[model samples]
Target: MEREQLIVKVCGMRDAANIESVAKLGVDMIGLIFCRTSPRYVSMVDSLAGFMPNYTVNQLKEMKNPSKSTDIKVAPKRVGVFIDEMPQTIITHVYNYRLDYVQLHGYENRIMIENLRRTIEPDIRRNVKFIKTLHVSTLEDVEEYKDYEGAVDMFLFDTSCRLGGGSGQKFNWDLLKQYSGETPFLLSGGIGPEDVDNIKNFNHPRFIGVDLNSRFEIKPALKNIDLLQEFIQSLRK
Candidate 1:
């Protein structure tokens, strides 16, 4: 049976080759993590886990500013992921990467979101979308952020854990039925290629998209492109 179109976002990306491969698939969004705590953090200097030399500032600049010989085919909109970062710092990365959307995966309250909205440059702000993350474990978790409907463009629902995200965990999607907020949301957490059937069966008016992460990874920060391609194809089928 045909299904409603859903936005596909492959987050926690680091490798340049992998990024290019994923981009060519024409996924809706490609996420690059900026939070240091997460294994998927994009950095210039090599880190302890050796995920660095990964997605440095200069590399992102080069990707956005393509050269004559190096024709980068960026099909998906780049989404920058942040966790409790200062407003100015987040703004800097947004401008640096020419990010199309900023996913706040931290404990940023309404005030912080408001500050970010006000502080970001007008031109960038106009085009860039703000996706606020609501870590959910219960119905109350979804209710707490109701006041942020106007502050953000979309809401991302992920499983709550000690670590920010990329926990490779799935929340009780049933709890989302209790969400009566006006804004649409993307379902995340432990989503993998196999879950396509579950996603197809899941029904929700505000279900606009799905955020794929750890479950699709080859290792921490590196994605299994083939698996992702299959999942995307299945979603469209």
Candidate 2:
């Protein structure tokens, strides 16, 4: 089969302009950081507030207490990035944010993935997609997640960091060629403007898309829109 359409995901976005820029690229999705420890954490309730015009911020605000309501309307698919959070906290955010997907970026296991899938699927009206992120330091590390094959919706293979993904570090791309399994995955690592041609040459049926972060930045939480647009447009055949 031909490679799956590369999902150009612009993660860790904070402001409306960055969100708009990423959306304008027609990227598959944009991420909002909630982990308070991340510098990219979108702390400005005011900035998130600005999205009210294009989206339903009031609905997001209501998600403050899940005992009330858990529905919100937003565009480009709202993804919440979490790292080793308590299950209740994840559930509460899932309900409050009305998130479409929850990304497990920390040291979570098969049980955690299975338990998360069970906890939310029954309570929510719609199916919640789960993305299990793996931070690879070596090929051996990449081989470990074969057990979760059927449990997640997608696999996000990112470069390992002292903190994790937003660390903007990169690893060996050739190592991905060794990934032998049926699961589809995303390519993320010190990928930047220089790697587009190499990406086009990457021939894997499961190569879904590229996740762009630090390398495409003008600053933390801000993406260089023009550069992103140019890069995305180049992907067209």
Model 1 residue runs over 4 Å out of place are 1-3, 46-74, 123-125
lDDT of 1 by residue, 1-237 (tens): 444699999999887777767766767888889988888888855323443222345457676776622223445778889988988889988886778899998888988888787778485555688999999998889997676888898999999999878898999999999888888899998898889899988988888899999998989878898999899998888
Highest lDDT against the true fold, candidate: 1
Q: Per-residue lDDT tens digits of candidate 2, residues 110-184?
A: 898898889898685268898888889899878866967888888888888787876667788777777887777
Clashes of each: 0, 3
Residue 230 C-alpha lDDT in model 1: 93
Task: Evaluate all candidate structures by whole-model CA lDDT and list the values in order.
Answer: 0.83, 0.77
Assess the local accuracy of residue 83 in candidate 2 as a C-alpha lDDT between 0 and 100.
89
Question: Ten-residue segment with the worst summed lDDT in candidate 2?
Answer: 66-75
